[model samples]
Each structure stands twice: as C-alpha cells, then as structure tokens.
Target chain A: MTREEVAARVVGVTAQQFAMKTSDIKESDQFTVDLGADSLKSIELVAAYEEAFGLSVKEEEALKVQDVGGAIDFFFRLLQ
Target chain B: MKPYELQDVPTPNLLEDTFPYSLPPLIKFEGKIKETIDGKEVEFDPNEVRTRDIHITDTTFRDGQQARPPYKREHMVTLFEMMSRLGGPKGVIRQSEFFLYTKNDRDTIDACRALNLKYPEITGWIRANKGDFRLVKEMGLKETGMLTSSSDYHIFHKQKQTRKEAMQQYIEVVEAAFEAGVRPRCHLEDITRADLPGFVFPFVQKLERLSEQVPQHMKVKIRLCDTMGFGLSYPNAAEPRSIPKMIWRLRNECGVSADRLEWHGHNDFHKVHINGASSWIYGLNALNGTLFGFGERTGNPPLEGAVIEYVALKGGLNGVNLPVITEMAEYYERVIGTTLASNYPFVGKDFNTTRAGIHAGGLRKFEQIYNIFDTTALLNRPPRVAITDKSGTDGVALWVNDFLGLQGEERLTVMKVARIQRWVMDQYEKEGRMSSITDQEMEEQVKTCLPEYYQAHRKN
Candidate 1:
C-alpha cells in the first residue's frame, strides 16, 4: 500500500479504537498524550491495525510507534 | 574508593556463566572459608566440593516418622523405590535410615530390599544399647546409626547418666556393632549444644580410636546431629554452635575423615537446609535430611533441596533424575495424603507460578526472566500465571498461550486476551470478587473470547 493509503487506514483505526471521528485525528497527535490511548488501548490499536492490514507487527516495535504518522510510516515500511 | 564506569555495550549481557538456565545456578566459591577454632585460624578449601564425594543421606523413615504417624509398609516400599530413582545410580542419596524395632519395619525393609535397587542402602537406627545390636545383625544391614547424645542436656537430663557412664555405654554399643559386623554411625545428638572441647572432642577421639581397630569399610561414622537446631554456619561464631569449627575439630583435631562425617540438622531456627549444605563445604561428605524437611520438632534438612544444591555445587546432574522430585511430591500428596505448601520451592504447586502482571509479561517474552531456572525441563513444571485483579492483559495472554500450548508466531498477544482480562478485572472491580481466576475460568474465557484459536489448538 502507498503511504497515503497507510495513513488513511491508520487514522481510521485510531478513530475507531478511541471512538473519535477520522477528521479529529491528527498525524502529530501522540497516542498517549493527545489521544486517550492507555496501555491497553495502545495495544488494542495495534491489534486492530494488525487485523485491518492482515499483518503481525512485532510487539516491541509496534508499541514504540508514538504518533499517527509513526504508525502509518511503520505499517507502510512493513508492507514494502 | 576505587573508580568504576559503565561499560555500555550494544548487546545485553545475561551472565550465562552462573545462570545457565539448563540447570540450577552454579554456586561458585572464591577463596578459603576461615574459622577461628580454639584460638587458632583454620582455613577450609571450599573448592573441594567440586570433586568431593558429597551426597545426601535420608532419615525420612526414622526422624521423618518421628514427626508424624508411621507410614505403612507399602508406603515405605514405594517411597524407597521412588527415592532410588530420584537419586539415580550414582547414589547421590547414599543411605536412608529406617527403624528396625517393629515387625512392620522389618517387613517394609524386606519389601524395599525386594526392589533390589542399588542406591539408598537401607540402614537401621537404634538406641545406644547393646541389646539393639540384635536387630542390626538380624536385618544384616551394613550400617546403623546409634544414638550417642553429646550434650549435657541429653547425657545428664535425658539419659540420666554422668559423662563417664554415657561415654562407656556408647562405647559398649559401638563394640557390639563391631562384633555384629554392622558399621556404627554415632548419632552425636545435640553436638551443637555440647561442650566440644570438654566432651564432644573427647568422645569423637575415643570413636576414632575404636574406628582404628576395625576395617576401613566397617569404620565408625560420626553423624553431627544438631538435634536442637543450635548449629550456626556464621563465620567467627563460637564453638559447639559453629558448624565450621565443629567439623574442623572433628576432622583435624580428633582425626575423623570427611567421608565418615555427616551433618544432620533440625529446623527449629529455619537454618536446616543451609546448615546441611554448609557441612558439605566444611568437609563432611553426607548431609542427613528427610524428604520435605519432615522430622522431629521443626524438621531435618529437606532431601529435595539438598538434591538441587548437589547439582548447583557439582555443576551437573551426575545421573540424578530431577523430575522424580516432582513425582515424589505428587506421591506424597496423592498416595500419602499430605499437602506441600503451594509456594514451597522446587515441588510446590505455585513455585513457578507468577501473580504479578510485570512478571507475566516477562514470562510471556522470555520465561527465564521470571523463572529461577528451567523448572519446566528439570521439574516438569512450566512457568505459569495466576490471574487475579493484579494480572493485567499480559498475564491473560500468557495464561491463554500456555494453555493452548502455543509457541513462536502462534502465541497470542495481550490484545487477543484483553477481553478476558477485562472480565477478570471486572470480577474484582465491579463484583468485589476476592479470589484468583481459576484455570477453568481462564479456559472458559479462551473458549468464549478466542474461540478460533481454541478450536484450532486446544481441541486436540
């Protein structure tokens, strides 16, 4: 998938996980700070992304993705 | 102060030298262990344990029976057979003493002899009386432990004999054992509370002289019994109580060989197991212990703990079947109708089970992080997580993955078990549940939440 497609999917998953609108999510918004993703929520987001993309991200590396842009970039690189 | 700096490296150093994960962590010794005995400095070579013929001797039937009701003949036979396998062919558990007083005891000894195992040579225990020599002769045993109480507390109070009378009585029994061709292991009861210079040393010297008259195989053995659990392994400790000094005086001062010396201790002060192991380091060969530390008053050193310690000191199993310890524990519970504490080391039900979420997380990532050693491979007990309010999603994930026997890529992540964790949390948070989530509850949650994996993996 392209970076734009990855970004769109990442935003969509984050919105669904936190029960927010897609327009309200931002690339600079931190998963824990700006968005209300607790430890379990962050894990849930990763699981949701894994399900949505049909890919298993390494737990340590996936948990390191801090923001929406970082998640998109991580999945995009994994996809390539 | 010497300067120190952090030598940061790219990779983590797990220090596999000691924590090899395949066995118990190796117990390495640095220089000589020193003890001040009789106003003189004495040094004992701790490294000798690596090559020494150090081993465990059992008193389960003798002292172990003293704490509880007697085990049936069949129970004794079965335990004896299991002990043979547990100690293996090399006889790490060299001898097990039994009571030869009753018809039941003789019958059990015969039944155990019927198994025809080589290790754990059955010996008899009797009072320091010439009449009891008949039982040893009748049983045709090679060795017997005869009580020769060393302390004034025992000699004066218990035996109602002066020091001279007690020594003469003990010597007569030893002579009788020699006449009967049975090796006498003098049970120096309360040696740790005795006058080492005044009585214990003199008695041991007399035993040494008696041993000189006999053949090497039939020589007198001295069991330094800490009957009151007053023995101390601490450095610079005083005589009688100091295990190091007592062994030193017996070995160096009175001329007793390491092989002929044994350390038997009680757990009145919770120093039972370490004191037994310390005896090995202090130059004794046999550590007298009962299974699960079951003995008089508090208990003797645990035979199973000594087995693990043997591996640690020797740095190898040396044919000892470690898993039989688990089997023995199961036998003690199932057949013997006894229960071991869940948190008891090595054989407990929850010895390797984790209750903390952080520990479960580490266990999920790498079991060696939370586990003491490879208990799963060694003791047939894998690291486990007991889910409660404290066990977060990580614990649920570990429990689920371990239950399904999933490994590598198939192991479930915390996200997959989040719902179960949520329900577990709600049990306490919402419903004020105060107990741990049982394995059955976790299995049901797996079936309900992660039914696909359960179907694919657990159905078998």
Candidate 2:
C-alpha cells in the first residue's frame, strides 16, 4: 500500500471507530483530543486498523500513533 | 538534617537482600532490640529467629472450634491430614491441639492418627481438672494444653476463684499430667489482661520450678495466651499488654526457655498475627494459631499467615508446602462448606485479581510490578484480572491470553481483545450492569469476538 492508500484506510477506520465522516477526519487530528476517543476508543481504533489493513501491527507502536498522520505513516511503513 | 546525595546507578536497585521474590520477603535485623522493663533495659537479639527452631502449633480444633460450629469427624480428619502436608516433614506446624470432651472429637483424633502422617503430632485441650488427664492418656498423646486462667477477669469473675485457689487447681492438673506421662502445656489464658508481675510471673516461675523435677519430655510448656487480643508488640509498651516485655520477663526473669514458651493470640484488636510473630522475635519458639485465623470470638493468629511469616523470618520455606494452603482453602469450601473472605491474603478468590485499568496494564507489561510475588509458582494462583468497566483493554487482553493458556509473544495483544473490552464496557455503560463480568460471560465474549482463536485454543 502507498502513503495515500494507507492514509485513506487509516482515515476510514478512524471515522468508523469514532462515528465521524472520513471528510471530517484530517492528518493533523489527534485521536483523543480532536476525535474524542477515550483509552478504550483509541484501542478500538487500533483494532479496527488491524482488521481493515489485514496486518498485525505492533500493539505498543500502533497505540503510540497519536494523530491521523502518525497512524498513516505507521501502517505505511508496516505495509512496505 | 544529615548530609545527603543521590547515588544514581544505571540499573534499578531492586533490593534483593530483603525482597527476594522467590521467597516471602525476609525479615532481617541489624542489631539487638532493647526494651525497658522495671527500670531496666533488656536487649533481645531479633536475629536469633534466623537460627532458632521457631515453629507454629495449631489450635484449629480447640480455639478454632470455639468460634464456629463443630467440624464433622471427616472434616477434622481431612484438615488434620492437610495440616501435616502444609507443615511438611520438618514439622514447622509441630502440634495441633484437639478437644477431648465429645466422642466425635475422639473418633476424629483416632481417624487422623490412623492416617499417621508425622508432624502436627496430636494433642488435647481441656479444663484445669485432673479428670481430663484420662482423655490425654487414653489418646496416647504426649502433650496436652490445660487451661490455667491467669487474668483476674478469668479468676475472680469467670472461674469464681481467688488467685491462690485458681493457681492450686491449675497446678494439680499439671501434676496429674506428669503422673500420666502427658506433657502439660499450660494455656495461660488472658495473660495480657492479667497482673503480669503479681500473678503471671509468679505462676510461670512456679511452673518452671515444677518442670525442673520432670524429665525433658515432660517439662511444662508455657503458652502465653493473649486471650482478649490485648498484647502489644511495640517497644516499651507497658506490661500485661506489651508482648516484648511479657516475653522478656518469661525468658529472663521467670526462666522459661524459648523452646518451652509459646505465644497464643486472639484477633480482637487485629494485632493477632503480628503479636504472635513478635513473640517469636522476642524469644519464644512456638506460635499457637488456627487455620485462616478462625478461633474464639474474633480469631487466632492465622496459622497460614504464621506459616508465611515463618518463611519470611527463616528466609526459606524449609520443608513447608505452601501450595497446600490453597488446597486447604479449597477443601474448606468444597467439603467443609466454608468460604474465606474474598479479599483475604494468599488464599482468597480475589487476592491476586486486579480490577483497575492501570494495574492491569502494569501486570500485562511486567507481572512483578503489580503482584506481591510469584503467586503462580508459590501458591498455584496466577495473578489475574477481573473484567469490569475499570478494567481496560489491557485487562481484557490479559484475561483472554490466560484463558487460552497463551504465553510470551504468542499472547494476544490489547488490540486483539479490544472488541471484548467494548462489550465489557457496554455491560456497565449501555446496560447499566452493577456487577463484574463473570468468567462464563467473558468466555462467551471470547467465543463471539475471537472465534478462530477460541476454536483453535479452547475447543477441547
């Protein structure tokens, strides 16, 4: 998957997890602060990303992806 | 203030000197502990416990029975057999005193003796009456504890006898025990509430003098019974209540050797276990206790607690079988129909179960961070997470991995169990559930969420 593809998937997963629109989700939007995801919601987003991408990302590293841009970069590196 | 500077190091100083995780944390003493008694400073070497033959004697059938309904004959026999294993070959739990009044008690003693596992040698408890000597002699028990009430509260109020009359009656029973070749352990009932200098010291001195005439095996053992839980372990805490001073006086002033002196305590003040342990440090060899602290009124010092303290003080298990404590708890629940308090240490249902999110996270990262010791290795109980709203995804992940018997990197991550954690939250949030998610419910959630893993791992 390329950067745009990873970004689009990460955005879609984040939107689905937080009940928001993919258009409303942005690269700079923080999972907790901007998207109103609590600890459990953050974990659920990581789980959603794992399911959507069909890859088992490192839990600690994936959970550390604070913003939408970070999640996109994280999954892109894993896909590469 | 003393001059101080940070001695920073590259690695953490985990202080293995005291907190060696394989064993109960060791009780190390640097120097002698001093106690002021009768305007004199008495020094007791606390380190003596490391080498001393300090041990536990049980009163489960005696004082323990006083608190609750009488255990069935088989229940007593099973508990007695389990106690022998719990103590092991070295006899850390050296003796168990039994009631001699009923035929059922006698049959239970016979049944226990029939199993014939050594250590926790059977003994009898009876009033200070010579007639009870027949029971001790008939049972062929080498030792028996005879009540020799010490406090004026017991003598004047309860027994309706003056101090001299009570002392005479107690002495006659000791004499009868000697004649019958049964070693008399004088249970100095309510010694903590007695006039120690006036009555207790004099009584113990006389008993010691009497012990001089008998053979080594027949010497009178003094059990300093803290009957109402008034004994204090603090330094310079006044007499009649101060455990240290009472023990010091018993060993030094009254001339009772450490081996012949036992500390029996009650939990009326929640100081039972400590007071019993402090007696060992203050120079007594035997701590008289009951299983799980079940005894008269409040309770006795928990024999299991004392067993843990014994390992801590000795810095090893010696011959003690610690996991049998778990077995004994199970036997009590399954057979004897008793359940220990859920929060009770070492042997409770929730003793090692963490419910908090942050604690579960710590447990997931490193078990030692939240667990007291290796409970799985020591007590046959792994540290566990009880799923609740407070138990986050970390808790869910831990519970799932443990249920699947997964280990190391094979264990599923928090992300894998996040769906189950959401269901757990929905119980409290959406459904307004007030109780924790039971293991059965969690298993169903596991089956529903991670069907493949559940099928692969738990299908059997």
Candidate 3:
C-alpha cells in the first residue's frame, strides 16, 4: 500500500479506536497529543498498526517514532 | 512517578460530599411475559412513554467494542441473543462499536441488513458526517446514533471547530444518514459541561427545529453524556451529585417526548449509574449501558448496576440475572486481557464479602435488608471477605470444622490468603496504572483477590 493508504488505515483504525474523528489525527499527531493518550494507548495503537499492516516495528526503531508520519514511514519502509 | 497510582489522580471538582451514599442497588428484571402457550419471550412494550424508562436500548456492540478488540458482527448477534435472553423493555441492536472502523464492520452491517433483523432498532454510533453515515449502509445498518462534539473542550481542542460549524456539519451529516435509509440517534457529548445558554441552546434549537421538520421516526433521539465523569457540579465531595444536574434540568424543561431523552456517563469516581438512574427518575425514556461497564477511560456506569438498581430499588423491570453477570464480566476480562478490582462492589469477589469482623458483623444483614448499619462502609470500602486461619490457632486439634465457619479461616496449607492478596497487590502496584481505571483491569483485580476464598474453602 502507498504511504497514504497505509497511514489512512492506521489513522482510520486509531481514530475509531480512540473514538475521535480522522481529522483529529494529523501526520504530526503525537500519541500524547491533546488526545491525552498515555503510554498504554500508544503501545496498543502501535501494536494494532503493526498487525493491521502485517509488519514489525522493532524495539529500537520504536524509539524513533515521534508522530503518525514517522510511524507510517517506519512501517512502509519495512514493507519496502 | 509510578504508573498505577498515576491513573488514580484525583478528579478536578472532587466536590465535597452531598447525597445519601452507597453503591446503587441491583435491578431485577421480569422481561416482557407472553400469553403464548410456551410463553415465548417478546420485545414489544405496549406501554406508553411513561415510567422510569420507556426505552430498552443496548449500546454493547456499539460501546462494548470500545473495551478493546471490537467484536465480529457474528459475535454481536450472539451477544444480542444473550442480552435478549437477559431481558429488556427495549430490544438489543447495538451496531458495531467502531461506527466506521473496518471492512469487517461493513460486512457485519451488511449481514444484519440481509437478515432483516428487527427488535433492537439497529443504531450505529457516528460522528456528524456524510462518509461516516455512508458506512452504515455498507453494513446494512438502517439506524445510527449521530454524535457531534458539543462541549467546548471537544469542539475547540478535539474537533477544532466552532460550535456553529459543528452544528451545520451535524445537520448535513444527519441528512446524509437519513437519505441512505438509516434511523438517526443523536448524541451531544460533554453536554454536562457545554454552555447551556451560549453553546447548547442555539445548537439544540436547530435540532428541535429539525425534529419538528422531519417525519416522526426520522426524528433523532438525543443522549446527554457526562463524558469526563465530572460528576454533577461537585464529584469528589462526600455527597456527590452526578455530572451536570443542570443537563437533566434542561432535558426535562425542554418539552420533548420521553423518547428524546437518554443519559450516558463515565466513572472517574463512580457516579455514572447514579446519574443514569436519576435521568430515568426524571422521565428520560432510554438508558444506555455496556454489559460490564467496559469502555474508554473509567468507562460508563456498569449497566449491570443500573439494571440491578432498577429492580432492587425502584421495583421496576430490567430483564437481567444479576448473578450471571459476573461470568459475563470474566469473558470481557479474558478478551480484553485485564482484570476487575476486588473492591468493585457488585461482581468483585470482595464486593459482597466482609473481612473485618466488625464489618462482617454489620454486613450479614445486607442480603435481607439491603442496608448495612453504616452505609458509608459499603461506599468507602467495598465489602471485603476476611479469611482467618483458626485451624492451628483455635486448637480444635483439627477434625476439619464445618469448612464453612471456622473462625473465618481463610488460609491454605502453605500460606495465608491475606498474604497472597498482598502479594498480588504488590505486583499490581509495581505494574503502575495511572490516568483512569479501565473495567477490564478492575475485573482482573477481583480475580486476583478471589484466591483467598478458594484457599479458605479447601475441601477436607
């Protein structure tokens, strides 16, 4: 899937998961952004994103995820 | 800072005490009885929109999915069947939890449409939008609860919209749902905090205008939610009112059919059910619930408690077997991978049991009278079961006493149950859970607390 498609799925799923609008999630959306998502929520979303796209975000790579775009890029690059 | 204790952060208003306090009573429901030869169960409530709640509604598939891994459509059907078995004045039709989450959600909606399921009007949750409502049709869902942010917090911080735009968007989105042949249920979030005069009044005036403009079933059923669990004006106080009694006042004063009013709540400090129960008393037609109060944050009032309160306190009907609900809770825990707290009151292992000799002595009469000598005991501290190991201390030379009442002996051959409880708690404390408590973990805590009872009752 293209970056947008992958991001769309992840954002769509995460938005629904947190009961928010997709517009609520920006490419720069931080897990702890105004949504007040804590670490547990962040981890849950990451795992779901991994599962939804069928890829792994290694622990070390996880430290580099700063926003939704970064997370999506990490997954997309892994796919490549 | 530790994580678990972090979730326990005190609420904002944490208002001083106010009302007669105790966990609300359990409800007993004798659902719609039939004159048919076999007495088959039925859903139609012939009564007019009067009484505690005229509407029987289920938000499980819609709300329960928020618990964790939302269910498959097939799973929803089975859950509905079970809820139907439990009984309700309103039949069960909670569209999937995520209003528009997945292809599977769409598939489930389509399956419901193909089956032509009727009973609990198939209402799905949605934001005010054309696409969001459009997905309902893909799932074959004909009814939907269209929610738009009403609270300033949601509009500005969450949705980044002015109240005016959200209202306009609401009308547009709702119209779309209608064009696609879906029933629209309207939910106004943070209604408890939204400015009644400035924000809410004008917005609702438009909806009122819409209700009058639309065909009857085409009209929306509005639900008021205490989203953040900011109970009434003051939640932290000893006698706390539920979130925004002012909302209830507005709901009542605004001339509308009881069908139009519904109440939803979360439990930051445990008053959502009381708020819901109060709404029922005030003539709101429909009340919402999750099977075991599983949802985001502190979660909504345990519908189990609401149903119990109706039957046990108000002499009304709910159509649920309160005893069996614990097992249903267990299922929720396993699926969500969490637990319940020992002190959760209704389903917890310690909710009905007593640990302190003085406390147990007072609680022994509760099953009969429904009142402990001091009601505060039940509130501040959940009924705890104390296990005293008298096997070695009582010095009966141990022929194995009644196994039922041996100085409340609650220890096992190797260790005391109290010690085990402490051990489990130590583990939980180390795990760290801040923000707000979720229902799944609360259930897990109860399971962890039960070992003492099991160990205490070891067979001879």
Best model per DockQ: 2
Model 2 C-alpha lDDT per residue in residues B1-460, reported as the tens digit of each score: 9999999999998898888778878888899999898898879999999999999999999999989988998888889988999998999999999998888888888999899788889989988999888888888889999989999999999999999999989988898998899999999988999998889889889999899999988899999998899999999998779999888888888998899999999998889999999999999999999999999899999999999999999999999999999999999988888989999999999999999999999999989889988889889999999999998889999999999999998999988998898888888999999999999999999999999999989835
Per-prediction TM-score of chain B? 0.98, 0.98, 0.64
Residue B19 in candidate 1 has what lDDT? 95
DockQ of 3: 0.01
> How would the candidate models be sorted by TM-score, starting from the highest?
2, 1, 3
Model 1 chain B: worst 10 consecutive residues (lDDT sum): B412-421
Tens digits of per-residue lDDT for model 3, B1-460: 7655445556543221211333343233334322211133222221222343444456766665676676766766555544544544344222223356667766665555455544545567777778775567766655678776678888889888887887888878767766776767778888766776677667666666767767887776677777777645332222123332343344544545666767777777677777676556545666687766876677776666655555544433444444445545565556544577766656654565443434433343232232331233432323333333211111111111213233333212111122233333344467553332232433343346444543655343
Write down the lDDT of every candidate, Cα atoms only.
0.91, 0.91, 0.55
Candidate 3: TM-score of chain A is 0.81
The positional error of residue B143 in candidate 2, measured at the CA in angstroms, is 1.2
TM-scores of all models? 0.95, 0.98, 0.56
Off by over 4 Å in 3: A1-80, B1-56, B67-78, B88-98, B108-120, B231-253, B316-318, B333-337, B357-386, B389-460
Q: List the RMSD of every prediction in angstroms.
A: 2.0, 1.3, 26.6
Per residue, candidate 3 scores C-alpha lDDT tens digits across A30-56 of 767755665435555665676687765
Q: Model 1, residue B335: what's the lDDT?
A: 93
In order, the first chain's TM-score in every candidate is: 0.97, 0.95, 0.81
